[model samples]
Target chain A: MNFNFINLQPYSNPQYFIYLMIALIPIILGLYFGHRFKTYEAIFSIVFLFLIFDGSHWQQGVNLLIWLVYEFILTFAYQYYRHHGKNKTWVFSLAVILAIIPLAAVKYLTAFPDNSIGFVIGFLGISYVTFKTVQVIMEMRDGAIKKVDPVTYARFLLFFPTISSGPIDRYRRFKKDYEKVPTRDAYITDLQYAVRYLFQGFLYKFVIGWFFGTYWLPKITASALVVGNANGGLKLSWWVLAYMYCYSMYLFFDFAGYSLFAVSISYFMGIHTPMNFNKPFISKNIKDFWNRWHMTLSFWFRDYIYMRFSFFAMKKKLFKNRIRLSQVSYFLLFLIQGFWHGLTWYYIVYGIFHASAICINDMWLRFKGKHKKQIPSNKFTEWFAIFLTFNVVCFSFLIFSGFLSQLWFGWK
Target chain B: MDTKQGVLDILNDLTGEDLSDQMDENIFDNGLMDSMASVQMLLSLQEKFDIDVPVSEFKRAEWDTPNKIVAKVESLENE
Candidate 1:
């Protein structure tokens, strides 16, 4: 039991992959053959979890263990109730609330850190795990899921590849992939994707993201701040715009790189995890941007939150106008999404900003639809739309980057 | 027209497609339309056919395709 090697953050550096690749070889071979080797897979996952959470991060590891136990009980109990007990909406809602309570509490505690109260049950990947758990409960409510397997639940929850940040695999989809071995031809495709994505991820995260995040972004930020210092204005400058683009690239590269690795590893393990991005900058509108950007999270929000909220509103006839109802739902969805990112003013504003942007986009779309004859749908117009959308999205990323907060408040 | 035709017509309006052959395909899963369009389709269903299906009673898996949407509409209409 020599656990002496330094525990590394998942995909934080190239060195982590050296260990990950070695650990995955057996699993990959097992998948390449007909067998999945479930027990070995589980053991391997646990070993990695222990490593990631054990060293200096051991307390968070212990927290994760406790949290997993709690979720297992909650989901199993809820599954039983759905199967055998009364189908009460309140009970389901209560179960969902309970499922999310720890993550919510942990998020809140981040704001009000107490060195004296050091027993917070928060860890990296808590949010992603909680998302998957809550999804199971929601699906159970819809009767889309009829059976509950505790072992599979545990595996899906702690699946290491997408544990930290996810392409957010659905339980049923994940189980199907886990249970069934892919055909050799199909697996060859997965392997191709896995290798390509891994290399691309290295370039994106290690090279491009590192260069932008570490070098270009900070340099631009310093220059932008100096500009603000000279003028004492709202930190508005060309350099600020340059910083926005730089920060946006850093963010896209880093997160996309991480997601590619996660998806690639899942593919290697024969799990076909869904993609998280789709050429987002080419989007012609804000709504289109959402469909392309962080696709899994946005789609999850669409399916679970926005869709449900819209349905509820339409059911109640909350607004006389259907458009107004959708507008409100978009606002609520994005605001909650923003809050999910953080409880900070900038995050909230970022959410509101997107909500407003999408609403405006929808309105303009309606106007365009009405005046289709008048409005030219030429190549130039399409290019203009893409260019405009790219800038708008980059600006939103600026808000998301939290530079404005430092610029406004830190200066004051 | 039958309930299925009525439902397909609503689906056509929702996605701006002439979906005559794609009734069997799951609209939501196939990306013909989305849940927001589901809301619009529901309103249209209520307005035209006077069938008030509760949102809570509907799941995308159950009522996403035009055929299933029609089945659901007819069932609720009979109810």
Candidate 2:
């Protein structure tokens, strides 16, 4: 099947109102039933709502159906193995492999020049969903949770607000609050907050992000190129670097605004979604930044990938005799975390740079005693760190944007 | 760094208060440790025990009580 971007022209057509109403039917029905029934029934209704939406577009609908099927089959297999007390380690390993398969196929295989099987497999929120599903299954195998009812599973997976972009709620948290859908007053309070957050998100996305993208950034780039003299050179002044930091701040606000909007809306619907950002800019160090920024993704990486790898490395005595286990663990964790974002040389370099910074910071702290005042605690130092961190992060973003090589090598 | 007295040493080193028997997991859980205290504890854990404690693991359940922390440290050391 060929991939076609949704034509929005038809959406603006006057006669499309009937189609819009038809689309709304499922959502209205789902919300009504979600309010009326208990958790399981609510989930089933939500899944039905998603199915209806998926049906609106044929290719997307098929892809969504395939994903649902994959999730169900994996969930059942996990549950069966868990119930029978089978070798859970193998089950978890298999689950991880299965989770990576779709992501790898979509990300890597499709990028091949000669490969003809590049029909778009819908990946809107697949990364987040697949990771969450894998975590849930692994946790279930580890006796961290019991098997969720099919409806609960469906609701957790297809909850509309978070299905697009997520703070990635854990099953335990999802199940607990979902069992007790909030009252009207609570819903009203949540709705107010949700509206406020959505407005803020719009302001960030359209006003701030758009202005910076259209005016501020381009102007800065032009100035830099002219001053630097080399072809495509962007020799930014220190002040421009500071402005870039502000641009980075705006980017975070815009993306995190969307995440907060999703979370707040979900909360009103009686779902306790995770917080994505936590004053990340105030972080004193890269380690602290990781702790506060995109918190759910970091936690997911820590719990599912980092911890498991560290445990395995230690178990195999890989950190024994010569190298410090802590350093090895830190390096491996960061590398894997970087690779999880994408399979690119730049990402690998970005990961290595971050890992190196963290490792050096770790070493410095060790050499200097807790009470040692070698590193300045003043405002200047703090601002300097922030500036450095922002540059590092933005450089990584440049790599992520696939313009690193061009920009670095003086290409237009 | 006596393994038995490690908790008290950590608490004393971190907060500079003689924690005595009053030292418990509640300090970490009840926001008594704060962010700075948590970071300090994390750094200490890494350096002293040669363990890499992911920042994500600094939740209330794992680090709140002295017993739990000791267990975590001991597990890391054994590993």
Q: Could you tell me how far off, in angstroms, the CA of residue A78 lies in candidate 1 after the best superposition?
A: 1.1
Q: How does each model score on TM-score?
A: 0.90, 0.74
Per-candidate local distance difference test: 0.85, 0.63
lDDT of 2 by residue, A126-177 (tens): 7778877887776776566667688778777876667666888887778887
User: What is candidate 1's lDDT per residue for A115-184, written digit by digit as tens?
Assistant: 7566645998999999999988988887777887888888899998898889898898899998898888
Highest DockQ: which candidate? 1
